[model samples]
Target: MEINDLTPAEQQVWRAFATGAAVDFREEDDEDTAEGAQWGPERTVRATVLRALLLNGPQEPGEIAAVKLAGARITGVLDVRYGTSDFAIRLSHCHFDEVPLLYGARFRQLNLSNSVLPGLTAATLRVEGVLRLTDCRIRGPVRLGGAHIAGAIFMDRAELSAPDETVLELNHVTIGDDLWAPGLRAEGEVRLNGAEVAGSIRLNDARLDRPGRVVLDAETLTVHGDVLMRKVRTRGWIGLRGAHIGGCLELSYARLSNPGDAALRASSSSIGELWLRKGPPMEGDLNLRRAQIEVLVLEPEMLPTRVFLSDLAYTSLTPHVPAEHRLPMLERDGDGYVPYAYEQLATSYRRVGDDHAARMVQLAKQRRLRTTRAWYGRLWGYVQDATVGYGFRPLRAAVWLLSLLAIGSIAYALHHPHPLKASEAPHFNPVFYTLDLLLPVISFGQEEAFAPDGWYQYLAYALIITGWILATTVVTGVTRTVSRQ
Candidate 1:
């Protein structure tokens, strides 16, 4: 039925809604709540009609949330502006149209489930009951500023938006978003999982003070445009499990405190961040699987892992600890942050636990260290070859003869340690092992002359005889890391 088909009284309330006066109940002055909220008999009835129209919007405009309640049972959009009254509201199976709702109104108890209302918009919103908008299509900026929904407010699979220069602003509100209260304090679960937003949405400066099973589990809050959140803060675990955020997602001064495995997994999308502050679960994994991060953002010192891939782009690992500041949150109160942000990605498939991530991260670090040492290793190798070529040129023939004999003797000594005096000395016992391995190595000079038990003994004895030869040889072979610095 059309909105005009309602009763005479319903039409009056509907006209009030058109004029942004629906938030003011009946028997109330528009002057009292022109800019805010005022509760009268008419507002309560209108809240009922509003609930019905949103749940099942073929409702005549004023016939939905426009009702009267004598007991604590208040339903629909509880438009109790200023007067304080407690009521329990329950409306199931409803519909909605592009109707407007005033923002500043308080309710006692409200629930709209199994509804199909699209284009539900609100202005100075304030509710105090269990507000649930499940299976509803809200096609505009659903603003709820300075409102308190003490009961559970569920919006599962409900399409919400703030398009046409509008925004979904939930300024200062509290919900049991909790799942057990009364005819007064919304006593149930407040779930907004699997919701879609066509325009930018926000819970700017909204406080979610619940800790039971995800204070706010918005498992999939898809944003089809850029999300602007400047000074936002969350107190519970925010579940953005598989959220597809289009455009550059900016959360500059947002402080999210989800002590669960709710890492911002903005993978497979083009995204950007300003100043991000992230903390791990007091348990699970914090993942950034295949997401890209542009240079506009800097990793916070609180982010445990050094650097990670953001959108198929590999960046250098930068220390999150800035040289300027330090805070007391160095120690995590929970188990620990999952060490690897690389493996869970499409490029690297690692095991599920924290240990596996630790190993991969360590390996990457080791390779970096080794590369640094390579330059020093090259210097040492060059010097060692120069000295060997110059000093041994004179004794080439004799050295070669001695090395040949030493090879056979060392082999026999090692195989039959009982004889050949190999049992008396540890150095000669390993001589065969070295000769067997080194014989195949091709050298520039018949550096083959450098092998043999006698030469090996002479090198070992150099420490006592003069020390210069041994010092030069040992120092030339090894690159001291500290000295290089």
Candidate 2:
């Protein structure tokens, strides 16, 4: 394109680039600094730089380095859709009246650091090099859906606001390297659903505030490296449901404040490790239903009262959390008890060499099952709990037996039953008589010798029945322990 063919605004930008007099916005502190800097006749480069670059091929390296359109007010849409370019477009410290549309555009690199834009719509855009927007302030939503970046997306210290809806959408995007956005402040949801990142997604020290809504929705996202969000403060939920993270998902020191709903939902997601320890107490449920995590580093006290852990499997739990602290976290669905929830907890306890804790978890499972059982089953479950602690506390059976013996002996002594054959009987001892009545298989000849009529006879029968129940419970508990070992 000739200089005469260029529009007036385009010619101004072309002259700036050709003469190497283009203002470097990066060196200037802000838009005011760029406006104050004297650059020949024009203080501001009022041109669509994207159009100028497409019309005239890639500029020289030295010229491109100094080709910053600082304090420029771009008039029309900078549409680079379906076009191919080999230039590193740097538009720092510029003010855009409209957002740069890069839909389906291919670029070598794109840098808009420290710029102020209405928003960005770069759906299906492909970049061969880094896409830097660090420290930029975007007032509207940023749509990067279906983008394929061979390098990182740097938005460190950026302030983005798109209230109520998604502020930054990176759905189905592929990033070769890290998405570095530390210290970012986003007012609305940041959706990364179905995105694939070869490196970590570092949002450390970022503040995502969308109360009562999802602040970070990364469902089905695949990250080869970690998702480091250490010290992040989110007012709403963080959904990582179905995400496959090769490395740890570290949310340490995070402050999440959505009490009515799940603050973190990672259901069916597979991750190497999950670190939630040393954080502010979570205000809402941390739903990890069916998530397969290798290692879970969480402090018991840091978790909220309501945590959905159904089918949530983990090989290790850090900080040595006791089963007592973890059992309450497996919330029941209505009145129905989740047996696998207890099983998972028991497995966790067993992994930590807490056999006693494992047994306690089993006891809790049986207790919960009792609540959902029929009347007869519930009665039997209660009996098992009281007699032997649902086969967990075998010593309880002995305690019950001793108490029954003492009561029976006291009753027999107080009644003072006469012997059937007073002269022929060997002795009339209440202790022996109670023992004879209590022992089902062993006959001490005291029951036949004694003649307890009316209420005492019925009491004797009750003692016999009690003895059988205790004996059966103790035997069943012993068998169960042996089988478990």
Candidate 3:
């Protein structure tokens, strides 16, 4: 695009470019522009300047004067429609009258840092290089849906405000590198639903204000690297449901406050590790239902009141959280008493060689099953729980046996009886007789000689049943332990 063929606004931009004159359109004078002779004549660039620059492709950095269209009220839409250009466009400290529409446009690199714009609609847009919007203030929503970027999207220190909807929508977008937006302040949801990122999504120190709503919705997202949110604060929900993160999902030092609702919902997500230790206490539930994480780093005291862990699997629960604290988290599943939740915890304990903790979790699972079982099954379950702690605690059987022995011995001592045969020698020791009745395989001369009448016979039968139950429970518990090993 020649200068003569260009529009008036485009001609002025070309003149600045040809003369290497720095254009100034900012309302306020800064230190760099304090000297009037240092800057070129002030000119407000229209959208045509952007069009002419793109049409005339590939300018080296500083080849043209550093165009300062800051606070320039560019009228009409700066549409960069279906075309491929290798130019690196830098429109820093600029104010747009409308959103720059770049639907299906391809660029080598783009930088609009320290600018004030309505928003961006860059759907299906492709950028071969970095797209920097650092320190920019956006009033409306940014739609990067279905966009593909070969480089990073840097929005550090940016203030984005889009109420009642997604402030930064990157749904189904593919980013080759990191989306580094540290110190970002978003007034609404920042969604990356179904997006693919080859590198990390670093939102460290970012503040999202959307209470009770999803502040960061990255459902079904696939990140090759970590989702680093260290020291980030959000008033709303953070949904990573079905996201597959290759590196650790680090939320260390992050403050999430969404009471009653889920503060972080990673249901069905697969993470390399989940770090929630040494952080600000999460106010709401951390729902990890069906999530598969290799390592879960948590501080027990930092956990919220309710945590949904239904079918949530982890290889290790690090720093070895105690069973007392860990068990309570499993108990808060929405679907009460999820057996898989217990199983997952048991597996984690077993991995750490905490067999006792693993057994405790299994025992809790069996007890939970009893609550949902039929009446007859429930009766059996109760018996199992009481006798040997659902085949996990063998010591309970010994306690029951000792109690039964004492009861039977007391009953027999009160009423000593003679032998059934009158000729038989009276070897009527009540303790020996009680022991004889209690031990199924053992027989003492006292039992043979003495014959009890009335309720004593019923007492003998009760002792016999109790003895059998204790023996059976001990055998079952031992077998289960051996089989597990």
Candidate 4:
């Protein structure tokens, strides 16, 4: 890397590398323009010159050595694989002829803000400081798998377009700080599987467009801080299965669509707080099965046509509304007749001291349970529901008992029965006779001593059968209530 072989622009960049000075090549009015403009001799630097300076640069006394070039067309491959550099590389507003290959390389910091490139391949690379790609327009994949970044990676307003393939891959990476990538537009999958982020991953207003496929897959990703995706728009599945987020996962105002498939799947994940309200109805199913969330904030209208909530455990619910408003979502659970789902909602209601609402949830659970039972079991369930509300409505049982008592007493009062034993009969009172016939286990001497003939005898038989049904249903309801407690 002799200085005599360098172009005039390359010689100028070399002189400023040791002092960390930026070489601006664009005119004042064309500051916002790209590297496509034709420039003569002064605005072009070969990638070999930049790579050589990065590998071995002059040490300045108490001054940091950095390669900071702006608005220049970088030609050739800046291959630095398996190389180690202590200098910071800042190449803003530059256009690269080929993707810069930094695989398995270790550097202090790399900032390529407002640059246009075919792609970037920095897999297994280690950055001691931040990796900035803000406002970059990349046409190929940006692979960062197995990388370790000590500081944040900023990709604000960056556009990474690699259709039907992965645009950004950060799997198994360890980031010491946040992944701040707001306003990012990616045309393919953006994965962060098995990655551990010590700080939050903010992707607010980002649009990930990969229809009918998974656009964002962060499965098993562990984030120590919140994952905010407010106002974001995604056209495919966003999976977070087995992920653990120590703070809130807010997806408010996000429009997610992966019709007939799962729009968001967070199964087996553990999140501190999950918010899904204030958004339009999602087109696909929402699966939260086996997920444990501390505080779940959701609106009924936000629920999709199918939702899998089996075994989902949440300590609290937002809005603190009554059970009726929340019961509709349980009805939409794709895993039908999950008793735990209903019980979890009832438990959440009981925690807030809303016992009435809790009872309603329990009643709804029995009704849902009826749908999964056999014919005989369903028949019995219907009887119990109509009579006592499966013990959730104790007043309904009392009403049934009083109604039967009045019906039997009035029917027998209109017709008297002959005495079976004239000497043993105490009186001919219709109310006492009806009570003796209706009470299944108790007798008041009237039913044993008297005998009804013809139509009166049929009425007595009907009363006896109705009395047994009432007694059995009451006992069954009481037993169920005790067993649940």
Best by lDDT: 4
Q: Which digits, one per residue and each the tens of the lDDT, describe model 2 over residues 158-225?
A: 99999967899999999999999999999999999999999999999999999999999999999999
TM-score: model 3 vs. ground truth: 0.86
What's the count of clashing pairs in each model shown? 48, 0, 1, 0
What is candidate 4's lDDT per residue for 302-353, written digit by digit as tens? 8899999988999998878878899999999888888999999999888888
Each candidate's lDDT (Cα)?
A: 0.39, 0.81, 0.81, 0.90
Model 3 score (lDDT)? 0.81
Which regions of candidate 4 fall more than 4 Å away from where they truly are? Answer: 29-40
Model 1 scores a C-alpha lDDT of: 0.39
Q: Which candidate leads the pack in TM-score?
A: 4
Rank order (by lDDT, best first): 4, 2, 3, 1
Candidate 2 CA-lDDT value: 0.81
User: Each prediction's TM-score against the native?
Assistant: 0.38, 0.86, 0.86, 0.96
TM-score, candidate 2, is 0.86
Q: Is candidate 1 or 4 superior in TM-score?
A: 4
Greater lDDT among 3 and 4 belongs to 4
For model 3, residues 115-168, the per-residue Cα lDDT tens digits are 778899888999989989998889899999999999999999999999799899
User: Model 1: per-residue lDDT, tens digit, 387-421?
Assistant: 33212222332354346436544654544322234
Q: In angstroms, how far off is 273's CA in candidate 2? A: 1.4
